[model samples]
Every structure is written in structure tokens, then in C-alpha cells.
Target: MASKQAQRLAARQQLQQRMAVKAEEERRKRTVLWSIGGVAALVALVLVAWGAVTVFGADDDEAGASDPDVAELVDEAEAASDRCADVEPSGEGALGTPTEGLTDGRPAQDVYLECLQMSTPDASATESCMYTSVDGTSPTPLSVQPAAGTQKMTIVTNLGTITAEIDTAGAPCTAGSFTYLAKEGYFDGQQCHRLTTESIWVLQCGDPDARGAIEAGTPEMAGAGSPGYQYEEENLPVEAEANYPAGTIAMANAGAGTTGSQFFIVYEDTSLPADYTVLGQVTSGLDIVEQVAAAGVM
Candidate 1:
């Protein structure tokens, strides 16, 4: 009986020893798992930081390679988006086609407006801007001469007399604003600020200082800046399928509803979405555009 009891006690002691060894092994395993998890977390954080640095780092070479004319267009687009950043888009679309006199496409002007409405800072939105039911037979006129009932003004330069007709029917506010500025002689004596030879574009005579001057954090000269105002998109007409042709006088938008004193004359007929207000056609002098281009002010 004593030997049997001794064997049983020995077996019980061996069992306890095995349980302790297993517990120690489990503890080691738990520690290793936690250590591995911590290392993985550190590695993930390092990768994220490295990715951020790579994505946003400055690329001077890439910027230098970009065409200046294209850059200017991009800048204008950014400015336009920034100007309209605050305005929310309404679902209602504009009244005319995507290209009024030119070709046609999908997505109406309201969709473009929506894009400008939703665009973020440092981004741009685009659409096919058109004015149709217009006479496609004649290439658009170089100088505008308004009909008798329309609002018109003539600016005489070395090239000859250039007539500008305000489109009251399509863009009343823009037309009115332009007429007001012209009557005040806002464009007179101001040199065509930027003349791009390669693009054949002329941005002329609106800056109070004819000399090139840029405002800090702004594109225009100090005096040329529109003093805090924008007009509603209600007056403008738009079409979904067509785009506005060259020689169409349109209001350059800063963004949604942010039309201003600055305007653009399309030197070459290219397709632009109905983003700008087409005020009128140039009835006569295009040589003046060439003359303005020859005189560099930018």
C-alpha cells in the first residue's frame, strides 16, 4: 500500500510540472504577439509618412516643362473656380446650347455650373459653352456694332474703330456693368495687359494702371480688382449640345455668380463651355487685336 501511494504522488507532481511549462510557453507567445503588432503599427505609420512626402513634394522641373500658355489658361480656370467657391449650384440649367454657334455635346450649362459650385480650391471645372440660333454663316465679326435698340459703344484705337455691344437680352447685369465701366472710361488708356503671341490672345486695356502690376495673392492689378461683387447666373442663356464660337464677347467668371470688370476677347475660335457670358459679337476691327498683341505689356 505505501509503494502504490508513492507512485500516485509522483504522477500528480509530474502533471503540475507540465501545466507550469505550458503556462510559461503561452505567456511567451502572448508577449511575442504584442511585440509583432507594435512593430507592424510602426511600419505602417512610417510608410504613410513617406507616401505623403512623395505625393506633395515640390516638382520644379515638372512645373518648368509646362507650357506657359496652357498654364495661363489653368490659372484663369483656378481663379474662376475660386471666385465661385462660395456659391452653391441650383439644379436649373441655363437657356442656350453647349456651343451656341459651333458644334454640340452632352451635359448642359447647369452641369458646368454645378462643377464650379463643387470645385475645391486649387482645382478647375470645365464645360462646353455655346450660343446658338446665331448666324453661323458669317465668321464672327472682329469689332462689335450693336443694333439700334441694343446697348453699344465704340472705342477708337490705332487699328480703327472697334464697337462693343452689350448683350442685354442674354446677360443684363454683365451688360449693364460693362456699359457702366465703359461710360466711366475704365478701359480707356489702360494698355492691353497681356499679349500672348503664340496663342494669338490679347487681354487689353482694363487695368487702371496700364503698367503691369499684380496684387499680392490676386491675379489682377490693385485697381483692376472688382471690389467685392458677383452677379447672378439668371440672365445668361445656355444650350446643352453646342459651344460658343470665336468672336463671341463673354464675361469671364471668377466663379459662380462672380462676374467682374475683366472680360476676354477670343482671338482664336476654340471650344469653351458656356462658362462665360456671351455679351455680343465683334462687328469690325480684328487688326486692332493684332496691334494689341504686338504691344507687349505682360
Candidate 2:
């Protein structure tokens, strides 16, 4: 009887030890699984953080490249007004005189604005004109006058399309320069840099370097960009009451005789001193400009 009881007790002890060993093995497995899950969660968080930084960094770089300053543009316009005061029109078709007739079938203008080359003795000998780059790939300025006539130009923009009837009769050189630039794709992907809702109501554009929609932090390339060349102004109004009416397309220059690629569209009857060269009249797409003006500057 004593032997049987001892055997039974020993059997019970072995069973308890085996059950404890099994429970310990299960606890270890659960711990390993929890550790693996934590590691995977950490890896996912790192990947998400890396992606966000990359995307935002790219956006910041782009914004920095195209950011523009409104105050600088206003200052530039004021400075241009001062420079134009010293300029006086001179040539065969000076302001208030009839233009020489061209072979192209266009009416002779009652008044013609001619380009007058001014001496810049104080400037560097290498500097032909302000902002004119001699190293650029664009065509050099022609010494002779361009033919005067009517031309239709189509301007395609991200917002919409604009078509204008260029009056080469009044401003032959201005029209010719535009035609040449258009053919070269100089204005493609360029931005309209300036918009003024106050005193002057217009949208200025044609800066190749300023190639983007107007937005906060967009670089101000207006008044700074050029077509690697400069030319004399044309088609200045002779009368004091002459004003830039709605749908008028005109060139934007730093001063008189400093015409380049920059131009503007008049959305309303805005009066100012006749400083800019009148390029043509907008046949379509004035509403695009009006819409931009209504939105105000970004």
C-alpha cells in the first residue's frame, strides 16, 4: 500500500512540471510576436515621414524659383516714369507726323512714333542697351525699319487664348519684334508677372524667366527679363488726352526707347502719359485679363 501511494505522488509531480514548461514556452512565443509587430510599426512611420519631407521640399524649391515682389514692380514703374521724362522722339516719323507708306496694304497713319537712339557715354562700352544680352541666342536688332501692315497674332495661355490685331503701320518695329519672338517660342511657358487694380488697371506679361501663374512667392521676373536685345519705342500718342482704352495691347518698357519683350493689356480706359508703345488691339480674350484683374493679385 505504501509503495503505491508514493508512486501516485511522483506521477502528480511530473505532470505539474510538464505543464509549467509548456506555459513558459507559450509566454516566450507571445513576447517574440509582440516585438516583431513593434518593429514593423516603427518602419512604416519612418517611411511616411520620409515621403512627406520629399514632397514638401520639392514644392518649396519650385516656389522659391518663381516668387515675385509687388513693391519692386511699383518702384520700377515709378523709376521708368522719371526716365521717360528726359526722352524726346526724333526720326523720319517722329510723334505727330505721318509714317512713310509701306508696300504692305495698310493705311498711312496720321501720327507715327519713331525710335531715337540716345548716346550712353557714361555706360560701359560693352553695354549696348540696358538689359540687352549680347551672348543670347535671339536674333540681333535690325538697323532698318520693319514693314508696316496689319497682322493677326494668337497668344495661347494656360488660362485661355488671346488674339490681337497688330497695327504694324503705327508701330512697325514693335510688331516685327513680337512676330520674331513668337516664331522663336520666346513667350511659350512664360508668365504674366504684374496686375494692377488701382490707379492703373492692366495685366503685364511676356517675361520668359517669369514662367508661371501669379501666386504667393512667385519670383518677380517682370521688368528684369529681356529678349537678349533692346529696341527703340514706337507709336506714342501725340495728344494729351490720349488714353489706353480697354482691349489695348501695348509694350512695357523701363523707359522711353527701352522696348523689349514685356507687354501689357488695358482692361479699362486708363489715362497716363504716352510712354509705352501701342502694339495693337486685342481682338479676343480681354475677358481672361478681366478675370485675372477681378481676382486681384495673389
Candidate 3:
């Protein structure tokens, strides 16, 4: 009897020790998991906060645009003209700048580099509805406010593909017009007619009759035509030093409500008045544009 009791006690002690060890391991695992989760949550929160600040800047007044510190930051950002990110041009263009007819006397390379620095791959998620009156001058979308979602506008060129996230919420009419035209193959095979190398850094395109001007175009005979209609302007950027940042795809208009099929992609921070409608922003393959811009107007 004594021997049996001693044996039972030994076994029970061993089992208890093993159970304790297992419990300790589980605790450590839980701690590790909790720590990881906490870190992830913190990162997510920080991103959300940063995004909120960025979007809130949509309204200058609300975003403290007049604040001295905020003004300084904006000034710093604009004056940081030397800030240029390195870009590798794999497309069919020169990788260097100072090409003939590219600069309006300024360091054009700085402009191109700054534009590259501001390029990003983020897409907007704001839901927009553009309800406006049209001149009926050209073919328009069947429904101005079709749905509430963003559209992906892809332009495939010999250099590469440049994709933009259409700001349907902000420029519904413009987006609708572009979408309709693209679906009808309107922009297909059209030449990117005009390449501006002066005050504005942009490549203008979408002119169906952009031929002949492919290599040689007069100032007035470029991408300057409508589908057959015109619409009211909507969603102008708020007042700012550089209202149009790089990677911005905006409607190229002669004046208000003159938006045609012709559009321009801003390759630098331009100080133009907020007279044009921001179509959307480039999300990918902006390097194609950078390469061309670097190669200069040809």
C-alpha cells in the first residue's frame, strides 16, 4: 500500500508541473499576440489621423491655412524646389533633362524632379455627385449622376500605361464625359498633341484630330476640341500657393465651362488660378510622364 501511494504522488507531481509549464507558454503567446495587435492598431490610427489632416486641408480656412506655422510649412514645401526623387525611365525617352525647348528659363530639371517627388499611388474614396447644367454643345453622358463611386481611367501609351482614379464624387460630369468617350474609343489612338515646357508643366492630349500636330503643332491647333457639348465647372481647388500639385490630371479649358476632350497632366506644382476642374489624380505609371518631361519637348 505504501509503495503504491508513493508512486501515485510522484505521477501527480509530474503532471502538475507539466500543466504549469503549458499554462506559462500559453500566457507568453497571448502576450506576444496582444503586443503585435497593439502595434498594428497604433499604426492604423496614425495613418488615419494623417489622412484626416490631409483631407481637411481641402478647406483652407478649416485647415488653418492662415496659421503662421501652417503658412510656414506650405512655404517650405513650395520653396523646397530642390527636392527631387530619383526616377528610372524604362520607357522610350531620355533619362536626362535640359532637352531643347523644355525650360522657360528656370531650372526645368528642378520642376520635373519636384513633380516626381510629389507623385503617389493613393486613390481618393470620396463619394461625389455632380449635378449641373450643360450647354448641350456636344455629346454628353446619358445620366450626369449615374452612380456614386470612383472610376479607373487608364491611358495606354507607347511609353507606358498611366492610370488615374477618377474623382467621380468631385467631378462627376467631367468623369462621366471622359468615361463615355473612352468607352466609345474616342481617346484610342489619338496623339498626345501638345507638350508644354513653360510656366505649366503638362502633356495635353485627348484630341481625336491630334494628327499632323503629332510632331509640329501651332499654339492654337492642338488638343482643343469638345465632343459636342459643354458643362459647368465644379470642384475647383481651394486657394493655395500650388493649387495644382504634380500627378494632377485636370481638365484643360480655355475658360470656365470650356472643358473639351483635351486634358492636361500636371508634372509640377503650378500656381495657376483654380479655374480648371480637377479630373482626378495619377495613381500609377507617372514615371512615363516624368521620363517624357525629362526628355523635354520633342
* Top-TM-score candidate index: 3
TM-score of each: 0.41, 0.52, 0.54
Ranking by lDDT: 3, 2, 1
lDDT of 3 by residue, 124-161 (tens): 22223332334545445543132235666666565666
Q: Local distance difference test, per candidate? A: 0.44, 0.58, 0.59
Q: Deviation in angstroms for 239 in model 2?
A: 4.6
- Report the poorest 10 consecutive residues by lDDT, candidate 3: 113-122
- Which ranges in model 2 have alpha carbons more than 4 Å from their true place? 1-138, 212-218
Alpha carbon lDDT of residue 191, candidate 3?
A: 57
What lDDT, from 0 to 1, does candidate 3 have?
0.59
User: Which model is ahead, 1 or 2, in terms of TM-score?
Assistant: 2
Top of the candidates by lDDT? 3
**What is the Cα-based TM-score of model 3?**
0.54
- List, residue by residue over 1-298, the lDDT tens digit for candidate 2: 5698899999999999999999999999999999999998999899888888678654443322222332232233233322323323222211122223312111122111111111111100011112344467655543322333565666655455567787766776676566545544566555566667766777877766654322233444334788888777778865555388888988888886678888888988778788889888988878877766655553
* Model 3: CA > 4 A from native: 1-138, 215-220
